[model samples]
Target: MEENATDGLPLAGVTVVELCHSVAGPYAGSILADLGADVIKVEAPGTGDYARDWGPPFAHGTSTLFHVLNHNKRGLALDLRDRVTCERLLGFILDHADVVLQNMRPGAIDKLGLGAAALRARKPALITCDLGAYGRSGPLKDRPGYDPLMQAHGGIMSVTGIEGGEPVRVGVSIVDQGAGMWAAMGILAALNKRHVTGQGSHVSTSLFETAIAWMSPHIGGYLSGGAMRRPLGSGVTEIVPHQAFPTSDGYIMVAAGNDNLFRALCGAIGHDFAADARFATNSNRVENRRTLIPLLEDIFRVHASAEWQSRLDAAGVPAAPIENVAQVLASPQTAALGILQQAPDLDLTLAGLPLEFDGVRPRYRHSAPALGQHNDLLSEPIAPEKAAS
Candidate 1:
């Protein structure tokens, strides 16, 4: 396709009807929107998306989190149960929408006659994605789920946090966002399939499934007769000397991932660990981690993190100082990447889609729409007979 044909954007001609709220479904819609799709976000008539009120840290009179998840789209507000409203939405989908991304409570969209099977029956080329709680077929599929709940239920919590400490949820909504990315990827693949088959497909994903996927490596080890994995704080079971150690001032993470790097690291620290049989190879290091780590820790504490970073760099060992969010945002690397973007029409700066095409990152066209901001699109609703015709 010509670049001018899509305004230099990949999905410029596609239309997405986003019946989503909170995180997962909206996040998927936002990904498509960033790629230049015409996304219309539908919400409840009076209250809008529940995420709109999710914080005291409001921006433009709504939660910042909502803005982050919902920018670059139009918004429509309607009561889906109303006969006329349902008909109007269905008409819009049949005529204009290429994808329907929804995460309504289990059975709700089906009860409203807007499920994938029903919509595909009307327009076989219409793709639909279902972002659900548990999954579509398990015994607990009907139950509502949140990110933390899935983390706990799907065994992620079992392998997180300090080994003997209380359970800790991952600091971010990893499961929800992962599920959203998966849903978006599935839809993209389905769209490709439609180009040849002239038929749509149902793309389904859930937070619980995403959580389980995050535990894949650990699961593999356990199935291979290894003991159940325990949390190692900042450490991983497979690699030694790969965790953070405290320096005189702060912490620095060192990763001596291979035997050569480990030998280099020992030489940099003026240690003879490479000459010791118990620390000669990666396998030996793993077996002797309980003894070796403390010795490295004592050596690291003699100098500051920066000095250690410089020494490790000179020796060609991978090491870095731990940084928080503020430090990360202020770093030169973050500015150079151009991931932070400003909306063209709003006083909002947000992280853009983490991708580039032909040396150009997707630009933010506009901020998130106000509730019902595009209701005029449905002002002249298509009559049932007229729509069918």
Candidate 2:
């Protein structure tokens, strides 16, 4: 047995049976794994996860997405189409597992007799969570959804891109990853409750719900006033001088959200906008954003983005450079945060949990597993070559 990093940690003895694939479901399992749970990822045999083939840029003959979302888990590839294989999975769940989470489409788990109601009835201490696309009770409950599709349905696309520009998906898988985080939160809550009652709970979240949750403030405002809020191209409502502006070389985001900061920002930029009646207060600046913003834009264009960012930082104003993905990955801040954890066995680097306990963040002890790597541990061993044909 390999050395598990979970010794002396919370959830050291917890076993998670993850019947999930792709980003959302797998990410939830990954979160638990990082917190020291023994997560068993059950993938379909043959192709394993469809995401395994989703890359032209494969790492070690597998999808990078698979690698990122699957660290610290033991992989078990099984052909669930076979009755015996499905039975083996459920047997392990009933006999040993603490939590079960799946993101398979609607009716899929039910048809396989792995529904939450059935599983919970068998093991009252088994926590089961379903990560769905739309929801469990909506008219579109059965409909499948992807990250981009959910983004369009959940109003993220409406407010995401440049003002009046063509609708563009958010660069990251916000809906999928957000839903995953929510699932982990729900499971943790349930686990806490279980400690008291010794009973498991059914938990669920959906991509659509995650997307809508992210847009709640904006949606609430629009719904109340019946006035649509247009995309501000990185600008926020009720705040003037809170957007990215082009400098001599690049763009930098600035936020002088209040009166004092506004005055300070004007001084830093060598402008007298604070004295102008039209830009004196936050309300006035908001009202005359068109006129005042262009003036700042003109002044900002005179200096490089680095110079403006430096001056704004020196003045204690909220400011950041509009860095590209590569710059962000290579930044000192990323190194300082220590978010990246090493996986020497898999020759991979993964982002660790975004939090610390006792001043130490958990590290990845296990790299991602090969298909059916742990299948021998089960009574029925599944082979990756046995694709569901």
Candidate 3:
């Protein structure tokens, strides 16, 4: 493929019909849009996507979340139960759309006659993705799911907080976003398969599946039916010296993944603990972590976080001060990366896709649309007979 053939957009001629809401489904549409697909978001009549109102932090009178998750797409509002609208959407899919993505409750799309089976039967070339709450086929297939619920049920929260502390949420919607990314990846693979076999595929993922995937390491290790260990909080179970330590001022995260970094870290802190029998190797350190952690803490608290960070950096030890959100956004690295962007109609700065095309990050060609902003696409009234011909 020529670089200029797509006018620099990888998915230039692809069309996506997004039958979705909230964070996960719309985020998948945004991912496609970022790659240059023409994404048309189908929302409910009147109120639109629920996430549009999910805020005290509104931007331009709507939830900033809507702005954050939905960029570079069109919008249309219609109730599928309305036969005319359903047929129009179906007709649009049969005739024009290359991809259709939905995150509705299980069986809801099928009830509306727009499920993968129905749509694929009509347009065998259409790539379809379903983002289910739970998985598509399980005893809990019909169960409604969310990020926090998956975190709890899939054991993420069980291994998240301090050993005796209350279970804590991961502070981000990992399950939803993870499933969305999985859906997008599946769609891309389906598109590739279609290119060769001339047939589409049904790609599906769930928040539950994503949540369990996040526990692969911990859960895999416990396959022998051992009891779940208490949470270590900001530390990895298999690695030692990999947690935040309090300094005289703030805190610094120190990671000595191997023996070399461990030795260097010990040297920088002026500790001969690397020579001590109990802490001679990484495995030995893990076995004696309870004893070693306190000794390291005592040494760390003698210096301020910044001073320790400087020393660790000079010694080539992996270390950094724990930065808050504000500090992170303001850091020089963030500015250099230039992942933030703005479109003309958008009133606020937003983060763009974290990918570069030909060394330039793709800018938002359009901000999130208002409700039914592009309803004119269906103004001519859809005709299925004409599409099939």
- Kindly list the per-residue Cα lDDT of model 2 for residues 117-214, writing each as its tens digit: 99999999999999999988969999989999999999998888778799989899999999999999999999999999999999999999999999
lDDT of 1: 0.89
The true-versus-predicted C-alpha distance at residue 87 of model 3, in Å, is 0.2
Model 1 agreement with the true structure over 119-217: per-residue lDDT tens digits: 999999999999999999979999999999999999999888998899999998999999999999999999999998999999999999999889999
RMSD from true fold, candidate 3: 4.2
Residue pairs that clash (backbone atoms under 3 angstroms), model 1: none
Candidate 1 vs candidate 2: which has greater lDDT?
1
Tell me how far the alpha carbon of residue 244 in candidate 1 is from the true structure, in angstroms, after superposition. Answer: 1.0
Worst 10 residues of 2 by lDDT: 380-389
The superposed Cα distance between candidate 3 and the true structure at residue 163, in angstroms, equals: 1.1
Which candidate has the top score in lDDT?
Answer: 1
Alpha-carbon RMSD to native, per candidate: 4.2, 3.8, 4.2
Please report, in order, the local distance difference test score of every candidate based on alpha carbons: 0.89, 0.86, 0.85
Error of 1 at 358 (Å): 1.1
